[model samples]
Target: MNTHAQSPDKLAEKILRGVGGPENIESLTHCATRLRFQLHDGGKADQAALDALDGVMGTVPQSGDRLQIVVGGGVANVYSDIMSLPAMRGSGARPPSDAEVKAAMRAKSRGRFAWLDNFFEYLSDSFRPLMGVLLGASLIIAITSVLEAFGLIDTRATDKSSTWVFVDAMWRSVLFFLPIMVAYNASKKLRVDPWLGAAVMAAMMTPNYMSMLGSSSEVPGVSCTTNETLGSEQCVAKVFGLTMQLNDYGGQVFVPLAMVALLALLYRGLQRLIPENVQLVFVPFFSMLIMIPITAFLIGPMGIWAGNGLGSGLAWLNSNAPIVFAILIPMLYPFLVPLGLHWPLNALMLQNISTIGDDFIQGPMGAWNFACFGATAGVLLLSIRHREKEMRQTATGALAAGLFGGVSEPSLYGIHLRFKRIYPRMLVGCLVGGVIVGLLGGVDTEVFAFTSLLTIPVFSPMVTYGIAITAAFFTAMVLVYFSDYRSPEERAQANAERDADERAARDDSAAADVREPLAVGAATAAVGGSGASAGSPVAAGAPAPGEGIVLAAPVAGRVIGLDEVADPFFASRVLGEGVGIEPANGHVVSPVDGELVTAAVTGHSFGIRTKDGVQVLVHIGLDTVQMNGEGFDVRVEPGQQVFVGDLLAEVDLDAVHAAQHSTITLMTVTNTAYLASVEAHTGQDVTVGAPVVIVRR
Candidate 1:
């Protein structure tokens, strides 16, 4: 089972065979740590044999018939070795691009409810690529609003000058043709021919379709009527003896979204029904012929009805319970945006503007946006105060994007999600801003504009809008800044980590001037197994040769080999060779003399890199990240140099049990592959600082 005795080529062969030979491996690419495989049939791969293989650390069978083999720092070399094999040479495919790999990874990390995850992913993919053009159009409208506010032009006068008409067309170009774009994007998301999808939507927006509106009274086949409730005209035309509803398709996002979903099913079915050689011609020919009428007669009307139905509901809520509606929109957005459910609301906003002449949602939505920006601003201030260079940079950029571009994704993903404390504080700000908007009679905007500083003039009752957003911004900023985004222990650990990194950078700079530059592998590999430097050279600070590195028990516990650890990733040594300790008490301390490199804010894990190039990780409680630091009181900060037995954290073992997690504390040499050997001493009761593992380099 131990394939370490085999040569690199032999190891590769074993891996290839373990994954059901070269035939089963549809494609293979490797990241820095793992070999990613697109398999023809995942079930054929031998998980047990792969786990037992000497070179592989572990194997992850992912959703969508994909596989990942953890091979540590030597993944690149192993990938080359696999591809160079005689049987695999002809079977190998070109490596996937970074974006493709990232997308695949995202797919692999689907949530527990597959349908829910897929729904959100579909919506997100359909809208994400169109953001740039949407923003550009939004900014043009913002400029127009500013001009109108200053009385520069009368855009509503129907007798607009040629220059003003051209200006209107500039922004209108994006919104008017939005349906075609949405259809194209949605079709691509569903893996259908995008042009076919675009053509279906374009059919309804053509001049022939528009011509029927003016000829409704004169044309025998066309008839028009007015909707009493919405006060809008509806038209129907007879096509080949069948009555078909005729409606303007411009700016209708929901139609394309629904159409493409059905199209994917029909298109794939058609592919199966038609023969391969003649399929291309027949597929498009039959698809367009079948889809266009179905869309015009059924789907278009249904989609319009669906969008209007949702808009009407929101409209009812806004009118009857203005305060509730104001608060609800902002509150809902925070949860929706992260999962990409916000796009539906965004589509509704556009629909409302097109049908009702203005949208009421953006006014309340501004509360959420400003609150998000405020949270980022708070993080920026704290980073400045604590001298956290990385956080400061991230917060600065996120805040700028939020205020100027009205984009909240950077702040949400970059900072808020990483720290668990920022969201509640941000919600408080959202509530306050929403209440103010409601009491002030709310706000309305004629054009679809992103809720940003530059677009402020687009919203009616501008003074009321300004006051509410400012209140929201400062409230969140004050709350986040004062209470802090991380707990006291996390804050200290972060500062210590920051200090250690700064010191390391200085030392590396000083060492670089005197010594020959280290090999790329030596410089980037090993250390904390997280690609951190191994610290100063042996002569400068490392423990002398033959001395070796002794790792102490980080807590009072019954020591065991990594084989006894519960987690598969740990047991396989993909994170390096070490030991697991079934803790006898809650006290955890440093395992070796080293600089702390990682002190997870959740108080669950720590990474230490020794001056002698030995990297150790102290992980407490299996799956404690789910507990969110509820039971752990971490005391030490990262980057602080520590000797064995220095206190790192205090854990409440009972809380770990209550949270339904294992209480085992694991200490590992995360960079073991880069070392000569790592030996774990197990099967004994040990007090804190008792030697549990040894590293020989």
Candidate 2:
């Protein structure tokens, strides 16, 4: 399945149909598992059938996307395939009349303002993927903290004596150098020069004169035995040759982040003012000369002081309220994973952990990690017995990643975001696990060697870790199990609908034996015929029926139930009835109607008993009988009906795709026994609502 071409609405429809259409879906939620659809009845689901589908990995009844499906790592690809199916066209999938299409084209042409809106939408969507990069780096920092806490290495020792030296280096690199990565991505998004952004980031990293001012000398205090300067009364300091007792300020003063901001502004202004020919050399010179002192005397010192104050306050909190520190860190940690804001704080925390040989922040974050693990486990366990093969596979993959790899992206982006209903359960599990660890005084002094299931063994010796992991798992499992899943009745109803759709599709195929072929002629000559006389077909200059025709699917979906009818006694038997197509959902449109015909009794199938007496029957899709035609709206009636361009039925694409049947439009000639020859369309992809067959008599 080519997923790239599919639309989201179309994919949603296909999924809905596979699960027995909308009738079977009581409710739907997506999470780190499969799409967790609460079915009205479980019986309606054909786990094997869904599993057999192309692009489906497997399905599970319980966890992950809820109906956990492992659609491979390229599950998104599968989703795209489903979405592209015409049967899954969503709310927009009406069999548009020619007039409607014309109107839509006109409307589209009128809206030149659409490009701006599209540009913003594109940007917003692009931002989601970067979450993984930021989170990955933060996780590395978190891990370093855990490692440092174990006393495996001396944090202060910069030499080989300290394992922490390496850890510290890693943490610093990720934190201090983060702006480059962010800038690169931002530049890519903006379609600008990434290196320019990198240059800006580099400037921020450079040391300033303010740092030198901070490193100045401090005043000496008089001790009990030392009154040397006081007794002589020459305790004078000179500033600009004016002698006075001076308070010495020494060593590495803090520079304000605003200093960097000011420098950036100055640089930009200078660049503009300088002549383009000499701008590169002169701009830097002027900017450095002017901005450096201003930064040192003002912005630099203030910023440094502010940073120091913030650091001091944090330290005080850690010392005075250790419990609060422990609780707050874990609780808020996950929130930062979604946004790109947690890096700075995490960097500082890791540094403190290494420098002080004890970090309260890292310890708490362990609780958060364990909670996520537990939630994943819960989903996996619940998924074990799931009926849907695709869901099962997805859950397994996500669960494995969560448990062993410590990469929750697969789960978070693919499943969790969709299954928002599971959010509370997962949150509660995390909270319970975190609180337990906090209360137990769990201390994570060392980072794990790796973020994987293998590392779980390393943490086994820690009592608090053990307790936290256990609590998290139990909580997650309990919540998942007790939570209401799909009801049995809903599943049954879906199953019935699916069965009906299938039957209707079969009936349509049976009716194909009676369909008559459109007249054959040159492209222009055919246009003169009654069928084309109204106007040229939407896709003009299409190949005529007789010259080795290729039948492309009118809609996207699986090719379901291709068969021929048995008939003897007619000389035209060589013209077999055309193929039976079940679009992924019940959505149907006129393949070709030389004349108005019978609207099938089931309302699931329609017969365009064409003018030539070659009856063409089109079942909207397979297994729609159970819906009792609930979502299908007939636009044209039997006998009083219309031309090929007429709107015959508007099937609910979403409802059909959800039902799990391909919503392919079938073109079957009911009286194939009368034709002298029949040939299949040759193309790989035929446009929907286009002619697909030619009959010869």
Candidate 3:
């Protein structure tokens, strides 16, 4: 409702802190219904606490790497909030810095040629939302078909009856009005003027225009006239050699809209040449005159032909190679349903079926429908054994939609995508089902009027329809059950990390009660540095005379001094040298207490000076300069001074691994000979801020 644009980083930050910070989450993902996350520890999550916060609908654990938190219709808003939080500002989260945020936002922005993309994306986003509308209409059509098949509903007599007529009208309205719904969403995505888009869509749906196209016949008395005939004719027509044809540009073809867009641009350009005072008055008048007739005669007819050609091609493919439809439809339907393109094709097919009575919808797509049903059933069955309570519920909902409603969104988003490995299995099941249906000579006697599984009965009595559907569902379930889809090691690692976090949280809580006073004094000492006057021998564990400036490890890892580098690049480095730690195998951490004077041009190396005047060069890995800084996340700005252990950068070990390169952290004092000597810390696996080096003047 608030039309003002929000800063995405700020919004994401807010949501992250609200959800117990980044440390609480193991992983996160999003879908239409909610933000799904896996927590390090469910006990530490505070689900009730999260629900009490604003913007959260509800929280439920669904599956491995699946935690559902309903954020209602404003799910995107909440997602933004989570992404903006400082705690969630991990390697994956885009920073709030102007350049970074803008870059990330640009990726999600509508592109210049995004009309087709928006049309498809909008259709996919709304596919599930429109399920009810589609299902209800289809069910009614199916019921009528069943009744008609059994002689219970008399088509000839009922054609005049109000009841039958009402049913027919309902079916027609749903089909005809679908574009109106699509237009609304498409306009939203394209950021186009909604009223104008809808107006264009409405014009395409006009009864007279639609009727003309459906007939595929020419307008009466509007045939091509020869110049000689016109001259000799009784009425001497002014317009010659033009035939009026019914317009067929009712679907999602882009050419007519493109023409309109081009006309608008041309009109705007032309306005620049008009006299300033009369521009407004003449611009609209002249532009419409040029645009309207040209659009009607040329662009409109061309768009109609394009739309018909697409429809005809699809019909040809299904008719000639129906098995291909059987194979492809089910496989692609799930993937496309999530993005919304499948519906347009379905709409076009239905329209074709209605007009020509033997389009692809009744042939190949019919088999595909059954295959999809099987995939949904398979997902539902596999969900039964899921460990998470929330996931089980979502799975049940998905199954219901797939089994009875014929809606694929629940299964596609909730089940298939979450268990991504199961997707191929679902595809295989659909393929098998399609093959069976095709072998049995299945036919779609009625157009799918609605989107529900209940409507499946309408395609009954075609040999093997029941068997095909059943086999597909069972096969999908069996495949999901037997497959070792999720890795055991990953799950174990997640559990271990969660347990450690819980323990740490508990320890922090317990220590907080007893150490509050001490912590306050330490904070004061750290900020004010006034406690030296207290004469407490610089306090226990405080920096000594020679160690007055403790060199904090810039990164998290096992603390090691410069002497560890075996590469010739740093083997000759001496004491007072800057230190580096291997933070998780190959990640390099900063190794000094000074301002970041420079970031290397390639970003693989950085220079930092110790507080006591030791300049240190910390390079992440040998030949990492060749990496061009791809694995590094720089945190410090130039001229910003850091504490001994403040994080300067985060090196991505995974990325280094992917690149097949070693990540050896190096800390060298570019001016090390200036110091008396440098001593390395005694322990292994030292953390940031551990006394890694002692520099004596």
Candidate 4:
């Protein structure tokens, strides 16, 4: 029974039951502001009940058994609460493994372009592992670009000192051997032996293969020529009387990507054809025999032709209609990146660099990257102004990651996607920046660089790149600042919650000079007293002999036994008898007027010594200290005298949910050994100030 001490908890309970209980849930995970549930049976879930739940932003029912519960900011706390439920324990249906879950998500994709999804996923995974190295290389190039700009050193110098030579190699290493990296990554994506892919790509880069190019007359079976339009030398070599097309495969991603794909197919075929005993030896032998020849004859030439054709087509558009092409790329990237569909474009950029000596797309794309960081900057500003501690931390980390590392995934998944409003504002910034770049005849980079502010020096006419990215950054920051990322209702809710916390604080402060609580720790010998009315908010008067002193309910909700709580310390009775309340609302109030003892800086846990000689500890949530005071606001200081109903802290359960912690609040008598008896009135609903625990002498 999910008690309705408040709306959010009650809603959580209803959603659970509506979803056919914990037995129907395969697993639960939270991302930012939503609960992603993998259900055993999708048909068993009641969508209406889930929609009707308070604090539920919305429900997104995906294909198959995946369900997303948008619980706003407190999604993490709500997910924890759901998992903390006793019903969730020992669930009969086992959750899917990570691989299985990914497969299931992939299977759920349905559309005319389902193959596009798979293709993009393959491309994304292949390149994803290389993002770090790519960023490092870009930064290194930026350093050299800066050096050249300042006249400190010549980056184009070939006969410089050994140190300069090695420094140049640092950035060139990743760019020059990019094909091998791509081949390895693509092979891994195809579930083939990655070394084979690297080896095949490596064959073309070797001095032996490269040596064949200029020896057309000396080597009877070889011929070489440069393509008039493509500006790249092409060679044909005859090996064992077989004619083969050859090109320097360095920095050429198209060839290796094409080769590894074919390799996967041929390798798998050979594996099926060969006997198991010698399959390993025969599989590679056949793979090399079949794939090498086929690649040299077909895939290699086709890759070169394909890359040149695509680059030429895009370059033509950029020359004729620069504005449209410029805006198109940046806008398209925002959509493409989330689906991992941007890898092909990235590969194309590298292709342009290898063939045409430069790339145009990266310059305009910088506009988009800066815009993303700008939106994060705006959010960071808002968080500071409003004192939203969690949002502040999230935006700060994301901003740093973007500006320094040139990675957008942190901002994309961490902040931008979470708040729907950020996307529109960010798009506007991208548009403005692209238009500026296009009007300036479109910026181009002489090298393939990660389009970041730091890499601005790499772009030709650095002033153009600088101006465009600046416009993008300020546009997005200003838009987000003026309009704000959250909707009006969300802002109103936040204000209301804050106002309530303030009101509770004022109420507590105004009545600070009241009488002392019923008793101090002296209750060990003073349990003999009369009982108050059970119908009152709290059983306050006194207790009979051997009767435990009644401790008012710290929070409102259904009370479960200490053994039922998810915490080991409480469940093991190490913290004495106490009741866990699945909170309906988000507030931690004084159960009785007492001196504050332990006041955690994070505001998640508090210990109060009651006047009745009982030490009580109020824990807001399970493992919530990790949130570092994000969703909690402590109202009272340590040793401060507080009366009954005084607000000890104000919690944002939504924030707690967002942090991925359980909102099961516990109030325990820590020093039960000092008392005669400690009894709990559990297995029933409770409200703030209601008698839930009785500590007696």
Candidate 5:
């Protein structure tokens, strides 16, 4: 991947054509790998053309006008390039951010079971935002557990010192106040007043409400019984001639998620029934008055009952057949995420955390995430070997997002879905990882956290979780990397493309030399002959006026297309078309027979104007001009005439390196708009006098 020059500009143009151009793109955003687009009409996109593109791994047309272009790793660059296009210049073509994409994706869960979708989303959204804080709290739990293991603290003591009590409350706060947070988020998700939702849920946890339940001591209209399963006293209050189940909804996630869904329907119906004149005051009053009672009497009890049943079911499976339970979770997730079926399982995770004090689902879920990223790692290795720049970037970004962020959408759509072979290889890693965790007594966590490398410390028996995930990551990485992701035909096609690109670059020097008249040497190769054999070098010559222009590399280095520069300006090709060289030596030379137009006093850049009407800027490194000529020596001034390979400046690369500056010499034709075409020859190394770009007029 590093060997090739990433060129998203041209790739973006191809993607635009395949995607039915800028007009069709209503909105676009990239995650880890794929370019997600919400189009005006998905039917207008050319599937075959997109699939056939050199950089594109594959495509997925989702329900409605949602389309995904699998561009693994380099999607960010491609996105930038697409945004910089002249057609996308207008404000109307500007796409939404990734957050908007996620929000929209959450919104599109529809159909007869739309309420069910909204229900699951309510739970997910409620809990999702709190993950970081919850994970931090979980780590504190882990630390205390570790201390308790060493007898450093009497963790089980009923009476605690002020310091220990404060320490315990740190983690307990997350669980104690969970209902209020869930209520707020769920209400907002359902388009209701969040504060009202919090207020209603808060009533259940109040001292007065708990007091009415009658603890160990007896009270009027209250009764208590021992619950065999929980081994805790269950209490109830008799109100309005009916006994209502009294539950501690402190850490209960399901109750609020479900309760808010019901509240939204009741609230909306009330809005319609009541007249608009007095709606605002009465709507909140009637909705809360009616809904809070229904919640306390019915929904609250039902949610606890459901959570227990689901947790007990999974717990039974985990107890009896741990391997099957573990394997099934990871395997199902791969299929679940794309169709949005995974939300229910995610909800189940929160339920487990709420009722059982932890969730096992996230433990096994790590295997699938690692495996997905592993497949991407495999794709990246191959892209580097065969010089597929776009894929390399796509895979790189997706893998990083996976390992650190615990996200999977990028790898799933970008590489796995596009190349069917990845799924089988990736699943095997998942199975092995799950099997490893299962056989080793299974991994568990005390608090809910995303399964990421950073959260590994939160899992109990850290050794087991570490080994299992490491096995998963390496297993998938090795399988995908060694066996390769592409089919034989696809592999051959990619190899051919790489080989052809290399040959074209090598040929550019000799081809340009042979095509032009040799006034400098008074001799030239056969003008009308067929293409020269491979291994030909640039013959000395003076080009005819109409002959295509040849731009030489200004320094010896590995030549890459402008897309790999990590600067949006160059990667997007706003200046012109060109190549970037990671300079191996320190000297800068003239890349063309041109007159100097300008030269910066800082000595980090240059500008040249050719007799052939090509204006080129040779920028040295990224933001090196900020160095203020500390590491550079300028030899040429403005209006100086120079030929190809003529000395322009001598750079102190050691100084540049010490100063943390890149030495990639970027030579771009600044006036490309007036030309017929400017093509940069990339994916190969070059030296001074070697053809790095071909400008056709």
Candidate 6:
């Protein structure tokens, strides 16, 4: 099925139906080219029907109720459409409960080691929400760096202007308070009281904690020593006779992540042991009392060491194997970002900036960001050349987001991931950029800045950084534009579809001039508004019986070809030409505003007759009659006036699955032969109330 002509909303509705509706969806997520559905019942999905739909590249039925529908390039729009449907209004994905979250962690099998997925997901969720503030802070640092480069301001001056200090605070506030923010998010992810986690981390950052960091003989049981090589001071203070290492926790991410994890365990354990009613008060009190000390004395020092150990290892690698380090970072990021494994490296960058006053990772990482944007630029050029409007729009937006914001997700998910050929081309660009940076003694930034065009000034040896990113951008662009993102066969099909759409558009424009405008008043008079009683048919010179009749989808799901129907009678269009929906849910709605002429007692079928004499039949399953009314709940009576999207029936789809019957719901203009034209839009995922069929007479 080719769904090129369908809108994203229509495509989403059909996809939802194909996956067995929002009720069946345990969770919904999208990546690159596919809509990942965690379904409650995978068996209810009509895989063959979904594969036959337009716009859908394929369907993958995984273990459990996991289903992935490949939409390619425009998966984000499709995902949004599905979630915005009326039936899915409140059923869209939300934060799962603690048990559900645990189950999800257990179910993730993205890698050979399942725990790897959980680890990355945990790290990703903790920092993902902080992106906005981080980007804002990076931009502030970028502005100051630009001023410094241009000699407009001396940022390094000890006696700085108040305005400069204020500007510094704007960026520093985000970085300094970052530990508390990470603690909150990490705690929420672990289903702990986020405030308790934030409070525990905050205790270390208070002025009271900062007062302990000194080598003064006046302060009892406190000592400090300077590391000659590192040129940094280390201090220890006696807390209740236990020696506590005192380190500045500003801009520390690892500490909060570690602290929150242990805190979650303790917090939950307290809940289990304490009385349910009193647990609320006691849980927070006991958790803070216990975790605060543990974190201050143990986790804090360990987290610092862990962060330092990782940063030092990378620093050593950069010092010795600079070339490998440069190439490896840029090349690795493309894969890491998608799977969310890059958070550790990101943590290291922050640690380096906090401790050593500079970070080297972001310099190499700019190569990957530019390469990703470059691939999108290539796709945009190719899309323009081929006149692929959808791809052009997607690519243009993705490229802009990447270049300006240094956010790769839009480019990666919207364009690069959809095309396999682009990755190797993009990687070549990453390698070239990395090589240039390595050969030029590498680049370093004093601030944790995003490697966007605006933040380029933040990196030292700005000329080397510029050259590397420029090379990376153009290299990927040229390679992708010349080679083409799509396979030859795919390109041919796309061109053919483009040609068809153009031809149809021309025909519609030409027809619009000669044909009379739709008789809206006449049609409305006859059919009335949604709930109003239908009046008599219109007279001549008014709209015809079939004219201006738009049949909406009866269920949320993918609309497939009549031939995809398992029932021979329906498949052959013996009753009429129409579309078949692989339902996403069991609640079927009326597809037209008309009188319910026939509502089967078994609830397997319904026939509606519009005031203008247009006839429509909605058949819910193949050979479901033998099972009788065991699974179906009829919602409308024969002769009842109904409007589009009015509930008609609710079928127990699981029962149908057990009966080994197809849950493909069919909608047909049963009197198709008499109509001038009955256009059934198929091969699209659509929501209930989305137009699926149009008739002209």
Q: What are the per-model C-alpha RMSD values against the true structure? A: 8.4, 19.6, 16.1, 14.6, 18.6, 15.0
- Steric clashes per prediction: 4, 124, 29, 19, 8, 20
lDDT of 3 by residue, 1-697 (tens): 1112245455456556555567777656553335766666655555665555544434555445345664432354556666655556653332233222222222333346766444434343333344455556655565665566566876446246887888778755655575555545444333343444445555555774454442233544332321121111111111245544434343332433444445546555766888878975676566555654565466655654544444445556676887766666666565544533453465565565556653345344433444555555554554454443444565565565545545555565444543445667777777787777667665565554333444455565544566666666777777766772333322322232333234344546664433222221111110110000000111113235455445555555765544565543244331124444676644344555566645543345665655555555566666565555577776654446765556667777888777876566655544333345554453366655555555555
Segments in model 1 whose C-alpha atoms lie over 4 Å from true places = 1-32, 36-38, 42-66, 71-121, 151-167, 187-200, 207-220, 227-231, 263-294, 306-546, 558-577, 580-587, 599-605, 619-640, 647-666, 672-683
TM-score per model over all chains = 0.64, 0.37, 0.45, 0.49, 0.42, 0.51
Clashes of 3: 29
* Candidate 4 lDDT by residue in tens digits, 617-665: 7878887866656777878765578777899889999999998889998
Worst 10 residues of 4 by lDDT: 524-533
**Candidate 6 residue spans exceeding 4 A from truth:** 1-114, 214-219, 314-320, 328-430, 439-465, 474-697
Candidate 1 per-residue C-alpha lDDT over 1-697 given as tens digits, one digit per residue, 9 for 90 to 100: 2224247888899999999988887778775457888898999999888877776666878888899887654566788888788887666344444434545544433447888656655655666566566656655665665666577876676799999899889877976797898789778778788999999889999988887774345667898886543445678889999998888777676677778888899999999999989987999888889898989999888866754555567668987998899988888778766533455466667667878899899999999999999989999999999998877877886776677767776677567755657889999999999999999999899987778887798898999899989999999999999999986646654564465446545556655412111111121221212221121112112223345677788999787766777776676666667778899999999988877766776688887778876767788878786676788897876557888888999999999999999999887776665667777777788888777676787
Residue 99, model 1, lDDT: 33
Tens digits of per-residue lDDT for model 2, 368-459? 65565555555555555444344455556655655554555445543443333445666676677667666776555543233344355445
RMSD of 1: 8.4
Candidate 6's TM-score: 0.51
Residue-level lDDT tens digits of model 6 in 280-354: 799999998999899899988886565445445666788889888988889978876653345556767766777
Among the numbered candidates, top TM-score falls to 1
| lDDT scores in order | 0.74, 0.45, 0.49, 0.68, 0.68, 0.72
For candidate 3, give the lDDT: 0.49
Task: Tell me how far the alpha carbon of residue 245 in candidate 5 is from the true structure, in angstroms, after superposition.
Answer: 1.1
| Model 5: pairs clashing at backbone N, Cα or C within 3 Å | 1-384, 72-394, 72-395, 73-393, 73-394, 73-395, 74-393, 74-394
**TM-score-superior candidate, 4 or 5:** 4
What's the true lDDT of residue 313 in model 6?
66
Among all windows of 10 consecutive residues in model 2, the one with the lowest summed lDDT is 520-529
Error of 2 at 214 (Å): 6.8
RMSD of 6: 15.0
